[model samples]
Target: MFRRTFWFTTGVATGVWATTKVNRKLKQLTPENLAVAAANKAIEAGGRLRDRAVDFALEVRDNMARREAELGDALGLNAPVDRALPPPRGYAVIENRNSPKYVEGPGQKSTYTTYPYNRNEDH
Candidate 1:
């Protein structure tokens, strides 16, 4: 009797353990879990691609600026290089009151008044 009871209990325990493991594995392999994992990997890849693109763009801009300076020196242009940032249209205080002010009508819920001042042409 003792031997039979022990064997029966061992069998029940083994069956329960196997069932729990199989259920857990099936849940992990479901379509919803797989899709979510794939989406996360895709998002990570996209972010990496964007960062690489931005870095490439910045490097290209720097190289172009350097090449332009070298060409200017070789050509012997005596004009002083100006790197000052121009003030934005709204923030710039126009000295000449007669300077032309171009009005842009409301388009797409945005209304803007722009001053058409040419930097090359001094007022």
Candidate 2:
């Protein structure tokens, strides 16, 4: 009698646990939950793809620069030439069209002139 009672209790407990587990899974399988899960997975995949692309681009750029340097050395063009940066264009210069410096006389040509300016041409 005791053995039969123990088996009956164990069977009831197992059935209850299985039913709860199945119901929980069914709730998660709803359309709304499924869509959310799919979107989250897609976003994760996109992020990974973007990271890979950026890494690939950086690698390609680094290799290209190195190869160019090698080619420059072979061509005897690797010597460091004069590297000078131009003066910055300030807001004052850009806005001051009436300034004497900006006034384009026959001799003084504006840098933005459509035609080339030659000092020898005036002589």
Candidate 3:
């Protein structure tokens, strides 16, 4: 009667819903779907790694340039060289390699260590 028809319809709907859910799960488990998912994830990871590597290289280059300039200034390497003569007025090298090497004239009094000490020291 009416109750029987209602139960029959309910059972059919439930069966159809279960079938659709199982078919969707099976599609996800298939080799093609899994491979596509893995490939997408790998591509995403590679892109992230590449970006990080590029950032690190750029940082290293910047710091290296900065350090090179600092060294050039310390060692007097940035100064223009005059190949002709040993001029009376110029930069002088101190005993310490870490110190700044510059002087305007022989008459100037400065903290730089020079010739007097080298003459006094026993070689």
Each model's total of backbone clashes: 0, 0, 0
Tens-place lDDT per residue, model 3, 1-123, is 999999999999999999999999999999999999999999999999999999999999999999999999999998988889776887664364444443445676545545543443432
User: Please, what are the lDDT tens digits per residue for candidate 1 over residues 1-123?
Assistant: 999999999999999999999999999899999899899999999999999999999999999999998898889774687899988777565444344443334564333456476684454
Distance from true position, residue 113, model 3, in Å? 51
TM-score of each: 0.47, 0.61, 0.53
Worst 10 residues of 3 by lDDT: 96-105
Candidate 3 shows a clash count of: 0
In terms of lDDT, model 3 sits at 0.83
Alpha-carbon runs more than 4 Å astray in model 2: 82-122
Native RMSD of candidate 2 (Å): 15.9
Model 1 bad stretches (over 4 Å): 1-21, 78-123
Give the Å error, residue 44, model 2.
1.6
Candidate number of the best TM-score: 2
RMSD to native for every prediction? Answer: 21.6, 15.9, 15.8
